[model samples]
Target: MTGRRGPTLLSLGLNRARDTVTAQTPVTDLDEQTARDELARLAKVLGGANAAYHTSDDPVISDADYDALKRRNSEIEAQFPGLKRKDSPSEQVGATPSEGFSKVTHAVPMLSLANAFDDTDVVEFDGRIRKYLGLDGAAALSYTAEPKIDGLSLSLRYEKGELVQAATRGDGTVGENVTANARTIHNVPQSLNGAPDVLEVRGEVYMSHPDFEALNARQAEAGQKQFANPRNAAAGSLRQLDATITRARPLEFFAYAWGALSEPLAETQMGAIERLNALGFQTNPLTIICDSPEAMVAHYRDIEQQRASLGYDIDGVVYKVNDLGLQGRLGFRSTTPRWAIAHKFPAELAWTRLDSIDIQVGRTGALSPVARLAPVTVGGVVVSNATLHNEDYIAGRDNKGDEIREGKDIRVGDWVQVYRAGDVIPKVADVDLSKRSKDAPVFEMPHSCPQCGSDAVREPGDAVRRCTGGLICPAQAVEKLKHFVSRSAFDIDGLGAKQVEQFYADGWIAEPADIFELRAKYGSGVQQLKNREGWGDKSASNLFDAIDDRRNIPLNRVIFALGIRHVGDAAANLLALHYATWDAFSAAMRTAQEGNPAWNDLLSIDGVGAVMATSLATTFNQAAEIASIDRLVAHLDIQTAARPDTAGSPVAGKTVVFTGTLEKMTRAEAKARAEALGAKVSGSVSAKTDILVAGPGAGSKAKKAVELGIETLDEDAWLELIAPL
Candidate 1:
């Protein structure tokens, strides 16, 4: 074996004796000890390499070295049953499950792709497709080759023209419902132009290079944790609980396929992409129409050579049967479409030394451990750090308390396996135990906050360690300030990350109060702000106008604009409705913080918890902060809440469900129109539903309407119902 041996003999759980040497040199020559050692070594190597590639946008290892190690790890696991670890590199999928988003079941399944590892695989795939279509070799067959976006796969459902739902590819059967979050993405149209009456378009939502860079820069400046790669950033952005938050994140969508459509698309794959583009959907621009698989291979080579120049991440090229009819004939097998195959670009891997481990605190106060590595590149990005996740992750320990790889430790200067997939954060997939330095030191998390030296306490039953410094901490303060000026917050124009940092550094603006005061010193005191290199007279006026325009912001915007921890847009809206005004809300928070009689009442709110209440109270308690708010109010106008229109309404508070395809208006328009007429638009049809607006090809919702005995209206009837009054 080329790696360290496992620990002293332990019970194998089977009826095997101690020192039980295999009579035939083991069924698989790689024993459990050897497998564990090799697996760990490979993981460390891959993990470190991935971190370098993503964080720095520079690659270190060649594609071949990474693939060989990955394949070897897979082989070893197959040969050694006892050595497989839960956190083993071989078991990792793409990224961790996104947080803060409600899980949704996809209406149409998002299928996985079949792979084409070599020319032979491509030829065999073509042969199978032709065989299924009963076509001879002489018959001309074409394929569409597109860059396989190695990012999260999602389906956007639209009725009429309005987007209603977005789902992840959860097991290909169901996925998380991230409709609100998906709507926030600018590239993801809320209402499509000339869209199909009903369409479920499948796309790979990714982060562009520019956006990813901006996001990371902001993270670094704020001293908050940064994503390892663009894919991770996109995934995290898309999975936010608040659609507003997701919307604020720089997310882009590229349509790749269709899920469920009311009407047939084009005759060929290329035609479908064109049709998608015409419908105002952002289709992958790299799609090429090829005469044969050879042409596809050529295109793949060209793409591989141009990979560095591409703005978005790509793992390989996907070759699909061009003819729609032929694709149908080819059908599907298991989780993949038989008519299509993804010819993956060779894996990008590299070698780097693990320098140290650092702990990062998230917005929610959960502490996460990250590995600092010698800067290197595995893919296109330069990765200096990789996620260690938690203490359990670092110890090579499993759920059962069994020491993984015989208690092998990941230490400083250890060569590690680094893997990257699209925008997913790079992770330490394995450790190269064979190359472990004798002088390498075991890694340990700090006992105190790395930034503020506050006691980092691990909450009971939690995996993360959090700083006790609260608002006073520099990292937290900077991040909170940034969040306050975010799009979902005050949304002040010209107060982007760079501008905010510049103003903060110059002491021109320390808090929100300083923003309103800028106009007060418009001429001399703040002359530099106007004459700043990027801030000309026109730009300065625009910034001031934007700020002035939002002076009298809505209650919900005010609440969210405060940047309270864990208080997202939805929570802010709920709080606004409960309190109705700033004074009442501030009083309530004070009472809750002081543990007064109203404290329980505060917690009684649906989503309010101890942490949220504490955060709210802490924010309101600061005199300077409160004074800043007063100053802001002096120059601002507060808008009153809009009253719901209910006069002479036919369906006031009536539960209505919409189904099928509508021709005249987009589903969003229809829903808004219905809501305006005092009806509540719901996703599913229930007994409580009074009316079901059925379009032309109504699906399950219509069926449910019949079962529930709800009155149904077709597209024309729905238009008639709302047209009169």
Candidate 2:
């Protein structure tokens, strides 16, 4: 949420244009307080939209509505710059990376592009660029026009002609490490020739129309869920935790950009793209240099006419300054490059009848309402469902409880207009009151969980209602068990979702602990798994062997496999790396639950916040949960987190502490830098602390370091010491 930050690039370019604000008052007419409040609301809405689109690939709002709100935010900010929030949306690019994969911080931020909605906007964009460069009408300028592929963005890093890492565009700065999955893509090269010594190739990962259809056919044949669109399928495939799953998916890449280059590929954008093509990379054939704004728009129109025949999804055409030197001079805004703009196509709309509304509970017990609609074609795909977002959305309210759709609420048996432009999920755009049934009642969200019948509560500042059933809820339990054996967790080779569901139903396994006792309980009884309808002697043996194979697991895997809410793989790794051993982590959690300083220690681990700290404490405090964990631990040998190699790093494996206000950098940046250099960043100074970096206003921590005779360095000294890294 912009909270205090303000609006970001996602607010400007991610979606299509639509009127989201119902208030009649214009931005210029609003008072300062009203404007501030509106800005905050826009920030929250845009932030959530960004996360849903970038992190989950499930957007909750229509692209049009998102665009409208973003424009309004910009207007308000422009009229009142001093009222901008601390966490402005304008400062953010994408949501934080998901926890399923390792995090990779990009050498250069992958900024988003500003958008041009119409010919007027396009002309304005060109004028702005020319004006910024102080160019007159006589000075010739060139720009590149290419399809804006509606798929996931990827950055492939190469070192010395060898592919080193692949990452998604996560929050612009840090991304998910998808090297293994990227390697499985047919077009992603393992090695490159005539490439720079170090290069970060940026492109889109997409699925062709034919491949998407074929994959959907296979999914239907296998009784698996089909993808909503090619873009979604491509994104889901690329982000798969298992490389084998990614390998099975038909995905392709088109190189369009570069980051962190050792040497210039070419002086111009088109030339660079051609160079990429020569280096055995897929480049968009339609990309061309347009000498004028008229040429650019003409090319865009040509691409739009051929969009249906392209055999791939493209939501719009991207226009960029062709000259690399011009791009360098143009530079960037807060979260977008000033040298480029995306000219989006109009949104596709279709009318559908709302048949019914269904409630689905996620692993965390968030009750999501899905609108089941009569089969209708949206764009080219047949649509049967759309996301209702939350109860507020059904009641025609935005995240800030402001009226939307002219205060028109959604009801069953209503004729709804669905819209899908570039988003993976179709959104209910507007309701046709003329065709709505009079008897159709306004929908009411349930106060209890539909699955567990537990008390469902929506905490303050939270939009979704969550069930309080915890582990007792069957939906949560089953989902947790499935997640426990997921690719990043226990990863039992032969035990999958089907096996987990079957075992749970048969009373063979109720919890993760029961998984370890499988062979002991049913190895030679009448209840043996081999006697089951789908199991043979060999299959049953393999299942048991798979479970046994995971008896010795890494500490991080053990923590993540626990499926504690808010504790994802990345968070679990941080905890593991901090505590080193399972016993130490467990003991610390217990102490933290008892209101000891361990609670503060948990909070001090950089990314671990109070909410996450509370979740960890709550999980460890429960007797039932502790008992289950104890049983699970008894059957497994959890290894300690390995110390990183200290070959080139002086601070590797060392515990460092920072105290007081940092003048040179923010605390978060300082902590991140230390952690990146293989040093453990502790929140509090203790006997284990090897070095103390003290800034102005250093207090008790500094005194303690001095009393303990620990090595102490001022901010300047600390910076100088790690300057080599």
Candidate 3:
């Protein structure tokens, strides 16, 4: 989402469109309020767009534009499945038929196809289909590929081979009776000879580009309003109140699917499409049978290459299971069919002015640069921001310290290309040096933290420049507070990132310790949390109780909640396993501050090294931090970390180090498996190490382990050792 500090290009455009979205989209995942607000706003915008296009045949935005909004709505719904609204756009095909025509409820609901954003998604779709069908590698499977037409979804009902009713796919189940207008279209046959007794052919009603241009020419000559695009033109022409008017317009139809069939049309999807074409209906001629994922992607590319020349619009390529039997087995999931997908073309890119750059601080205190772009449409998504990566990137350097952009640099007022893909943040791809503006200044890294006024420094060999204010920085403090209740941390109920931010903003809480003290400070006074906005007696009480419940937490969680630099979940767990209690860990850290015997013991604990030990010691040395921790510790009983169950596991209670690449699995997978079986996976080899799994590329770690007389095993030997388990 575009930030609200100033008017982003998106906000400016939204204002120009006069559309009032309930709330701006949150930067990342949608919380409860953000989801509700965005959903309501999208519903209003899309519902309005739908009515305008379906009822009047005059759409305000392009087909691609509508798809983007609908796509955003779908994404938000997915992130918060529990917050899905009853009037969700995902459950609908189009707007309700206007009052001009009577409504028709179909026996079978017309559904929409799910979308695939890229090649990986297409491969995943194929793999998912195979997995669901209990199929494996080299198993024979096929799909029918065709252009996903950009037009209104209409269902043409027939009775005993006679055209009886024609309707729009309104909300899937019920639709407007457009029989009079539909009968005027040339491709729609009044009577069929070899069709099902109760056949309902469903497809799109579209107008070719030439026909649309000619229609617009005529409209201009007659002083009538011209449509925005062909889909709108065709939809408006077919949905005319007067049959004579619809008959005069050049509206075309392509029958690709059917509903409410009295009998099976064919055994396969392609055969059914052929049957539809035989019965006096137009079907896309480019439809092909694909036998593999590679073939499907190749077809998608082929169709995308020919999309513009085809005249009418096509947003992407649709893939359907060739075998109707397999399609049945695949079945449906909520709003879309499981056996089919619309692999959309990559989002279109647009050139926009690079307005300025903004700096954002993260939880780790790293200052990241962001490019503020003039709002522009890239694949229907309005992009106003892009990642600048770092100071070097803005100066036209790549990650490998090589120069890109032909030595050209991005600056304010330069025309830059922005690319947007599915749910991906738009990024500046290239700059038009020819359009670069004068007096543009180069971005410089800040010397002091913007959030806490602390000195910011770039550590040796590190690309990111970070603030050294630790938890004293407001930005770092809030982030640490949020992390203290993260999913992998304490995970207190009703205390999410949004709530943490709220608590920080309203002065109700600051540090992790402040959370436990909330009930004591505001339980009964006018400042009671229950009296706060968005809070009630039961909810606030539940929140306080939730806080109390987490008073007895695991040692690993307490260590992680401290947000000590370089101390990740794995490291915290290892420290907990080594010390077994908070008091022991604290005592060791206090002693380790002076580089005593406890310090060497700390460094010798598998992953714990000089850097992490120093950080742990520094944390306890800080008066402010120590006081905060002491207050937090006084409120609760901390449990010992859960050790891996060692029973029946051969690697149990062993210290192991994996050196070099393992042929059987990835390094991450191997380490995870080793830990699961009660083995302490270390990064470095030491005297305490029990064994070393050295692969072909083993380096210094293996040599050190051998020098220390630790047992060593090759990847094959390691696999053989665990083969029985």
Predicted structure with the largest lDDT when compared to the true one: 2
Query: Candidate 1 local accuracy as lDDT?
Result: 0.69
Across 1-725, the per-residue lDDT of candidate 2 in tens digits comes to 10111123334322211222533345666678667766776787788778777787664565555666777778878999999888777777888999999999999998888878899999999899999999987799999999988789999999999999999999999999999999999999999998999999999999997888899999998989897667778888999999999999999999999999999999999999999999989999999889888999999888865665577877779999999999999998889999999997764655668899998887778889999986543543546789998999999999998999999999998888886635457789889798787788889999999998999999999899999997788888888899999998999988899989988887778889999888788655334777888788888788788888899899999999988888997798888988999999999998795356898788888679888998888889999889989999999999989856556888887899987546588677898788778888887888899999986435567778999999999889999998987
Point out the worst 10-residue segment of candidate 3 by lDDT: 1-10
| Higher-lDDT candidate of 2 and 3 | 2
TM-score of 2: 0.49
C-alpha RMSD between model 3 and the true structure? 17.5
TM-score of 1: 0.47
lDDT of 2 at 339: 95
Model 3, span 412-500: residue lDDT tens: 78878777543356777788776565777766878888888888888876777898887678898888888899988989998899999
Better of 1 and 2 by lDDT: 2
Model 3: residue 419 alpha-carbon error in angstroms: 6.3
Model 3 per-residue lDDT at 405: 79
Clashing residue pair totals per candidate (backbone < 3 A): 52, 17, 2
